[model samples]
Target chain A: MPSGALLFQSVLLGILLGGLYALLASGLTLYFGIMRVVMIAHSAFLILAAYLGWWLHERAGLDPLLAMLGTVPLFFGAGVLLQRVLLTRLRPATLTMMSVLLTFAIALLIEGLLGYAFTGTQRRVQLGYGSASLEVFGARVAVVKLIAFGLAVVALGTLYVLMKRTRFGWALRATIQHRDAARLLGIDTDRVAGYGFGIGLATAAIGGTALSLDTTIYPSLHWHWIGPLMAIIVVGGLGSVPGAAIAAMVLGMAQSLLQIPMGTTWAQTVFYVALFATLAIRPQGFFGGRLAQRF
Target chain B: MPSGSKVLKLAAVALLAVAVLAFPSIAPNPYILSAGVLVVYYAVLATSWNFVGGFTGYISLGHGALAGLGAYSTGILVAKAGLPPFLALAAAGAFVGLLAVPIGLAALRVRGASFVIVSISLVLILLLVFQSWSSVTGGSRGLVVPRPFQLTRPEHHRIFYFLFAGLLALAVLAWWLIDRSRFGLGLKSIREDEDKAEALGTATYAYKLIVFVVSAVFTALAGGLYALWFGDLDPVFQFSILTGSYLVLMALLGGVRQLFGPVVGALIVGIALEFFKVEYGDTPLHLVATGLLLALVVLFMPDGVLPAIADLIKRFGRSDRTSIREVSAAELREQRLQNAGGTK
Candidate 1:
């Protein structure tokens, strides 16, 4: 219903948005792939990292990008400790339920602490580049978004190389494909799980920083994150990083295009409807292989 | 001596029932009475949830959506169709039960974690639907249901308290009947091993459907009661994830297999939340506390508080007779054979 130029712009914006979404979902899918943990509290962690970035930027007058240097490692360590201390104790058969409860608890704890510290007020990180835009094919694209997309592509590319080339990456991949067999091969699954959780949390830091630059955030942003993240993971096939990337792009385009005709709220509804339909038709997901193994 | 113990147990139950019935009358304050109403409402919801989750091992996260469906239906009927409050409540329950059929069909085919995921997705989808369909469903602002009875506000609170308490009692009785019935055994068998049960000709799908519908109906009744008590309805309040979590928490905190586990869990958690709210105002600390408690319970007392307490009581009392009944291997095998033969 819209003009060709307008539609093209929307698609471009959607692709840029999708790139960031893919980065966020990549961490979640990768964690699930290796450890069989869904990490329901992932959104909470992402929001927490965003809050941390906002705090450092506002209080210390540090740039948001530099703030991540401190937050990412701290989050990674916390993730490793979480997997080693708490998640490791739960039995494999009951891992899904236990992880759900554990992550839920973590989310609640984070939300409580954040609420206490920051109150429920919304805050945004303001970089000098926040308002800057560039002309691309006659459509204005925000400078921050462009930077974020580039960062996501680079990060994802690094992750891809890490998974395919390095010995640790092979170990991680082997664990994902066959954890028990990998364990039998003396891979030290505990170490792998700890690192996998760290990697997942580290990705959240990247996503949080990028997202805070784009929009206002509050503790309640976790609620908004879970649905879309879940949709991406479901569409991409759980644990498939490439699948997640493609799914994010598709969802982003669908949502943006729908927004033109249906408006924002309806557009959101259509995205979820598509997610639900896709899940119902193929629970294994768009590119899900033999990974149909239960969490 | 065993007969005497049984008599004592029955007497204790009767006294507890009488006390609960007279609570609103004896309590002077409106807040306490309202809390009592909430406890009853939660008891009904949690106990109904146990039918499928506790007994059948389905662990549905979408029960809250079914409850919302019932509440909204009652809201529409009372507000637009000009139906009486009580009739609307019954109709709401029926409607929600019917709605559960297709969702159950699609989801019940999966096992364990997949089932949980499907249930959660169903609730999320329902929430989206409820929020988007504003013209008929009142959108996000929600429809306000008019008070049906003419009484003082405090008196109205008392009336609803007793009404919910009655419903809670009815729900408990229904669960008790189901637990003692052959149907309950069949469900338990399915939970333990669906493939094995199917091999024995248990008709697992049919039984699961029945349990799902029954659970939905009772949960819907609780929702209807909630609508009446709140005198309003909102999509967020009705179909929230918190509602689902509360149901799961209550069921888990109490021994899921026990008839009164959910009731006890609801009461304890409800009282705990009230205490926290009074102490800390409206901070999110109460949710944090619940989350901590849930994690601790799962980690240490996986069987829940009731069973743990029961075990403690048995140990201190040193009563051999109080030990749980155990079936020997041969007897279990014979029962299985009998079940298989009966099915054939």
Candidate 2:
């Protein structure tokens, strides 16, 4: 058996990584919640954000967080444009089904474009303290991960405030619950969906930057991340933010804990198994709204 | 009575068959014949995928995993169990088809976007499973698929070409039979609206599971065939999401509802894919091209290029004979006057 301190260290590391996971999933759940769009491209956009952050850091000598100042708004604008231009044309009758294919295509487009811009080579956001570790209570914590955790908490906290305190939040929530009903209630549901999509992608900006602190970034990196994010949201009950957040942490911790006994490759199976289990047992998820009879 | 369009379609099918058959003999060298093999492989995969995606309206991005499983099955059976390559492939198909039952049941429970997610997860999980199972699968490094036949390179290509082509014909025939069956009609109704189909007394779940398993079997056969031909089996390439996406793209591009949709789609896409591979050593610009093409297909021609072209042909073919309302009163009067003068 592993030492208790080592277990504690793994738990801490998992939680830190889980924060990053939740940060990315927030956008995906929001898209699903507001417009029923299964944005398969969300991870691709996140990778794009990571590339942007990495580039800015490497070329402009700017901090990745500082790079977010530029990327957040840029990605937001791009998200709004995409949702309005390409996605709005889809009728609600086939939105749920068609969105998956469309976003998948879009994901491929982004991955290809990113690969063209920066070849398929793996890259990490170079943090000066990436290797530095801090000891706390007999557990060693990597400094970069701790910073990534901080970034996630700050971004998620901001998201909490925005969702709770803003007038837009209500409209967003209304649309998420029921688009037609929200429209009947005199809310501009289309506009709400557009902005909500933007906000979801904006969260990806924060997520990508934080993720790059510890993980590698590449165009096809989304392949590895997209599945887990989908699992996270599904387990969290599709579009519920708090549910996804908790699930992300739990799954992350589980994966980390499993990694200690099994090697890293085997650990990846946990998310997929969790996803299958969740869909089979309670597909509406722990916090998902009523399941739609969609096809 | 056979309609004019029906006759035209029959001719088109005959022409496609002749062209497919002639390629192996007329090929200048082995390389072209090998590409022909790839086209047939893709056709078989896409046609198999069409059983579920085309008829049942469930788009699976994880089907490559089914193929990967088939390849692994054949590999393990041949290498570990000492079964002949051909027998191993037959066994592999049955294995994958049986495996699809529970997978389909679990995944088919949730429709639409959720199903897509589950399908993708199925593939990724298999990829992880195969990669980590080092003892059996040989992990990421993969295993050598022993070539059973002792033939020259071109002769080998020609053999597999005909073999894969034979499978394609068999699969297409199966799809055609299913397309006309009561089961197929029920599947289409489910695609249109599962709830309505269920309420109306159709066993929607049973129909979907049956078709899903059938699709998995054909897909597995194609994958196993590819594994045997390529003489190598790896987790990354066998379970590639990109290949799965291509299968979807090919089916969609050809007109999912049509009998020959996937065949046409695979021909066009397979050639284009090969072109890009040759043009750009490995830049992924081809992926961008395919992505743009997919987006265009979804936006402009959801029913696929074949249907779109057929519509245009139908419109043009009947334009002059479409309606009597197109005749002006003056032209009608002139026609009547001309008829009277001619009678006099």
Candidate 3:
């Protein structure tokens, strides 16, 4: 019953939102792919990055995009330390369970810390172009969202290159494919895992910063994001990068399209419904890999 | 393993149950009695969660949704349908239990981490639905639950304390019965290894679904009771992910596979949380403390504090016995030498 132009507009919005979701999910999928750790705290790190960007902007008058210069490296280092210090020491038999618990606890820790500092007040980064929109195909597209999409594409492109072109990328890929074989080939997998985790978190930093451009964030906001983010990655297949990217777009578009008929509130149900349908029909996910049965 | 030890253990358990039952009698005031009700509420929730989480090894992060559904189910029945509150509570449990079947069927197919993801999504979806559907759920304004009976404030608190305690006992009894049942062993086999369990002819799916529904029913009852006791209900508080997190934390912190693990875990966490709330008033400090405790438990004592303490006791016992063995061996050799001298 909706007009063609309205449908096009929804699709466009979905794609842009999906782009941000892709950025959020990329690190989560990457961590799972290589480390076999589900990284439930991925959104918490994203929130932390968002908070960091907000702080930098408020205190130093730095642009949020510029604030990433400080935020990304900090989260990157924390991710590496988390891997080396906590994750690596878990017993193999209980690794999956422990990692889930550990990351969940870390999420709580981050949320509680943020709550302590900010007192559950929702904060957003105010930008010059925040309300500015550009006309595209008779649809008004927000400038901040377009910039977010652009930034996400750039980050994902860089990640693609890093995973495919670099020697470290090869080592990372090799560790994921066959851990024992990669270790036999003298790959310093421990270091590679640390770097992989770092790269994963760095993506979260980029995503989080991009998110702050448009969205209001609070300490417990991670709970809202974590579910959808996981749904994206899982629907794409757990550890597959391309799968996650594609699934993120699909979910975004579906959510947007649903808004046409169901309105905004009910449209949010699309993610979980899609996730449930995906698991029921194809537990291996759309890309179909080893289903991470380690737990 | 001895009969005497078994009898002693049973006696200790009975004594603890009796102490808990009699707690409301000695409470200083209505405040403490209300706190006792909270502890019982958590014990029921945690133990119910353990049915699927601890036994079946399928961690359900959305169980609070079931509890929420139960609360709403009872609330709607009592407020809208004008049913008796007690009758509504039982009906709510049944309704939630039946609801779990379709949910479990969809969610239980996935294993390990995927299962966790699905479970979490279930809770999130329910939260969204309940929040948006204002006509049925009363939206954010929430619904007022009618108290089943009219009584003085102290009497009201005391009655709910006993009521919740009775539910906790039922939950514990269910867990105990399942712990010794063949069906429970099948569930445990699935926990240990699903494929092997299936290959060995266990109906793993059926067992899991049954337990999950059972868990849902009990959890729903607890929620209904909570609604009745509080005389008010909000979607957010009833269906909080924090509640789910606490349930998981309690089971793990106590000793997942142990019989009294959930109760012990709930008691510690519940009392500590209440204490923190009283001391700090309204702050996020309790959540921080909880997070720290959970992290420490998972990192250092994955088997849980109870199990770790039991191991420590066993270790000390072994060392003492080993030292005694060495002394006795030396004494035996000296006696043999003396006997040889006597023969000469």
Candidate 4:
């Protein structure tokens, strides 16, 4: 076995990785909660936003973190437009099933466009402090990871408040809990769906920015992320925000810790294995109950 | 059925089969003949996927993995054990089909998005496994399968084209038998609603498992044939989600619910895709085009091209034969309003 210091350091690193993953999964859950879309394209959008961040950093000289201030609203608007234009027209009876194919097409469209524009080369957001590290408990931690973790915490915190405290958030939550009943009580479900989809996709802006800083990205990298994100959301109980957050961190940590014994390639199996085990044992997931299922 | 029309339909099918069989002889160049090989290859794989997906309403985005396994097994058998290429393919197909039992048990437990996730996760897991297990799979460096055929390149393509066409014919015959059988009804009931089907005495889980295995076998056979024919085994290409989705796309675009849907879809999509790749030289343009085509098909022809065209023909050519249920709710309401106005 490896030394205790490496394991301890990995635990911290895994938590940070989970936080980044949570930022992506939360958006997926929000879309599932409101519109029942699997949002397979969310992975593509995350990478697209990462490319945006990389572009902003390179062409405009903006910091990758600062680039989010511009990309979030842009993605939000794109999400709303997507709902209004294509998704809103789908029959409610087949929304869950049909959305898979629809979103899959959307994913291909985005991935292709990104590939066309950027090519398939891997990229990273270079930072002056990229190589800097701090020692703790005889283990070294990268500063970029700490900043990315901080960003996740802040963004997730704000998202929590927005989901719980504000009236708009309540409207969104009400729709998640009971969409038809909420509509019967005079909630404009269509509009809520639009905004909900928007807010969900907007989270990718944060995730993409953080991810670009943490690791290398390429146009086709979205394919690698899709399985893990799907696993996290499934384990978190489909539409539950808090469940997604917790699951992300837990799986993230499991993956990180397994790296010591499993190595990196084998360690990645954590998500797929977790996904299968969860579906077999607890398809409803942690917070699923009645809320997670659409029909 | 009218005797004359029935004879005509049979003749049409026979003519089409003959043409398909004769394609290798008539093709202008080896390039076109190889393209035909690719098209029929897709036909068999799509039909294989349709065995489960079309009947059960369960969309598996991981059939590519089944095909990949089939190809890899063929590679290993031929490369390591010195099995004849043809016999190895049959065994590989059977082996992967058997492998589907454990896979189906785990995957068929969930429905809807969960099923899609499970299907996709299976492929991802396999991709990782094959990539990491370099000793067995050759990992990224790729395993080389010896060319079993001693013929020239064009001759090899010709032989594989006939091989795949024969496979497609067998698959279609199996599908036809299944579609007309009691087992098909059980599968359809499960597709319509599994819980209700089980309550009504259908062995829903068994039907799903059986068909999933059957589907895996055919898909694997296609993959195995190609692996031996192509002489290379790359894990990434074999287990790709893109390949999986393409199978789903071809099946869906042609009309998953219909007997000829996958064949039609494979022809259109496979040919168009080949054309794009050839013309555009590999710039992701074909991907964009594919995405656009899939999006349009989903939006406008959700029932697939075959069904939609059939519906259109029914509406325009034989309106009196239109089923009441085929009428949209909005159209029914408008008709009711028009009748009320006429009575007034």
Q: What is the C-alpha lDDT of each candidate?
A: 0.81, 0.87, 0.86, 0.86
Candidate order by lDDT, decreasing, is 2, 4, 3, 1
Candidate 1 TM-score over all chains jointly: 0.91
Instruction: Evaluate every candidate with DockQ and list the scores.
Output: 0.30, 0.38, 0.41, 0.58
Chain B TM-score against the true chain B, each candidate: 0.90, 0.91, 0.90, 0.91
Candidate 2 stretches with Cα past 4 Å from truth are A292-295, B319-344
Ten contiguous residues with the weakest lDDT in model 3 chain B: B321-330
Q: Model 4: iRMSD?
A: 2.4
Instruction: Write one digit per residue (lDDT tens) for candidate 4, span B134-155.
Output: 9988998898999987999999
Instruction: Name the regions of candidate 3 deviating beyond 4 angstroms.
Output: A292-295, B318-344
Per-residue lDDT of candidate 2, residues B27-132 (tens digit) = 9989999999999999999999999998888888988888889989998898889899999999999999999998887788767677888888887888888888
Residue B247's C-alpha lDDT in candidate 4? 88
Q: Among all windows of ten consecutive residues in candidate 1 chain B, which has the lowest summed lDDT?
A: B322-331
Using DockQ, give the best candidate's number: 4
What TM-scores do the predictions have?
Answer: 0.91, 0.94, 0.93, 0.94
- Between prediction 2 and prediction 3, which has the larger DockQ? 3
Candidate that beats the other on TM-score, 3 or 4, i.e. the better one = 4
DockQ of 1: 0.30
Q: Write the per-residue lDDT of candidate 3 for residues B61-168, one digit (tens) a residue.
A: 777888888889999999999999999999999999888887787677666678678778877888889899999889889999888888998899999998998998
